[model samples]
Target: MLLSIDWIFIIEKCILIAVIIGISLVVAMYETWAERKVAAIMQDRRGPNRAGVFGILQPMADGLKLFMKEEIIPNLSNRFLFVLGPGLAMLTAMMTSAVVPWSSHLDIKGRMVSLQVADINIGILYIFGVVSMGVYGIMIGGWASNNKFSLLAAVRGASQIISYELAMGLSFIALLMLTGTLSLRTIVEQQQDHLYNFIYQPLGFFIFLICAFAECNRTPFDLSEAENELNFGYHQEYSSMKLGFYLFAEYVNMFISSAVMATLFFGGYDIPFVNDISFGQQHGQNVLAILQGLSLFVKVGVFIFFFMWVRWTIPRFRYDQLMRLGWKILIPLALINMLATGFIILLRNNGWHL
Candidate 1:
């Protein structure tokens, strides 16, 4: 009986992994479609609608084109590391979802079903650790390419990510103090009673949000991939699926980051006033679990749309200005925010709860 139970557990885990990966890929593909549509509207032009109804099939067509294209390797490049770079980029982007708490567990036929792939105690730390490592992919790829422009772009990209990560980490410190736990599940649970951290920590939220844009290389922070200056930037020397991986990994990273932001500051899967509804109470546990899952997707979708909207609306930041924003502005602001939060929390604990 123990062996049978172990087998069942393994099967369930495998199924969960498959579902998350499949959904992530689909979301990444459609993000590309949505981005193009958004750009077209901003530019006052009709976007890709020729391929299928509302241009829904354009991603598939683009995939086929990329697959059929010739794979190129420059003679001077380190072929192995060149290939490994994009693979690492894609892998790190996908790996971040492993710890995100999508929903509370479901009760199914006396068996508990976990909504997350892995509910490690240090889930938020795991996200930060993994995301910090993503810069290596771009750095390695650019350095291995043996091209001056690629190397320059890679250095810029590395510097930007590292600088912004400091502000991002500081922002999380305020949330950590409030929740008193690094586990994302516990953080989400804490928000169910009163308010989201975003309401209390608006300054930190704004800092983190802007830092996220820099980390993801989105405009007005896409200095690393500025086309006119760097000629397509770090992945400039790549072609075929290799180049595709770098680009695809970008959108995937954006989707994952948006999900993380939503989970962290926006209360994950908890809808406002949802506890007052009878549907959540009268229904069985399984039904409530499904509703929670739906809530998470809706939140994630809104965040994704906000990402595209900002990308289209903002202009790229100049390189020096980007550096100044990170080091001179955001860092100092984040430090002040952290100190204030700590002071408030201390006062509250002494019967002066604000």
Candidate 2:
């Protein structure tokens, strides 16, 4: 006998994937606009307002310009890997969002609809796996450029990411200890009724946030692209849209990291007083689900703004200081936090009220 398949579910999954990829691209594009506007405001100047109303069309214009520009290949570079670098960077940046829970869920035509693209049981592991792979993009790109500065920057970038990932993973271990699950959805659900993880895991949250900045190569930790010293860093030899992709991927990674932070520590889509304001009794499930989704977006937006704000406000760190901070400070601090969390949990389990 032939088995029946759920084509509707397949179509829904495809639509969700398309929406996520589209959102990531659009967010990355407009982040350029947002960054320029923020920098202009900070520096006391007018930002891009020439292309369209309030420069809303600037990203589109920029994309068109990049597309129209001639692609340049450096004479001594490895042509294949040079071309592959930016593509890999952009791909890894986009892939990290696949397992994040965008919102709780919605009741659609009597079926429960999950807001995430993928609700894999190993959501946190999946995020870490994809995020860790992003370094290869930089390493490959920089090596392929066939330039001394690019190779140095690539080595620095790879080493820094690897160092920070250890601290980042340790911080997650504390959260996992508290939540007792690696699934992002389970962690979010746990945060719904009580305090957000940020309250209890403040140190872990801080370490994770800083590590995220390093992972995404943001200012204060953006040694990989230190223009004055390294001459545009890893993508120094790239031009046109290839160059655009490298820059664009950085912002996309920043945006995704912000979203991940919000989801992991800021209660995801659970609003304060949401439980008190009964959804089934008043607004109904669908409307309530929509509100939850909106709440999550607001949280993600605030985090993104913070990311841009820091980029404009803070100066990049010196290389030695960056290494010292990540290794000597953050890693040790994360370990201490984990120990404290373990002690508290052990005490609580034993009925010790202190």
Give all TM-scores, in the order shown: 0.96, 0.96
User: Native-vs-model 2 lDDT?
Assistant: 0.89
| Deviating ranges (above 4 Å) for candidate 2 | 1-5
Collision count of model 1: 0
Candidate 2: residue 307 Cα off by (Å): 1.0
The TM-score, computed over Cα atoms with residue i paired to residue i, of candidate 1 is: 0.96
- In angstroms, what RMSD does candidate 1 have relative to the true structure? 1.9
The digit string of per-residue lDDT tens for model 2 on 131-238 reads: 899998999999999999899989999999999998999999999899988888888888987799999899999999999999999998999999987578888888
Q: Name the lDDT value of residue 172 in candidate 1.
A: 90
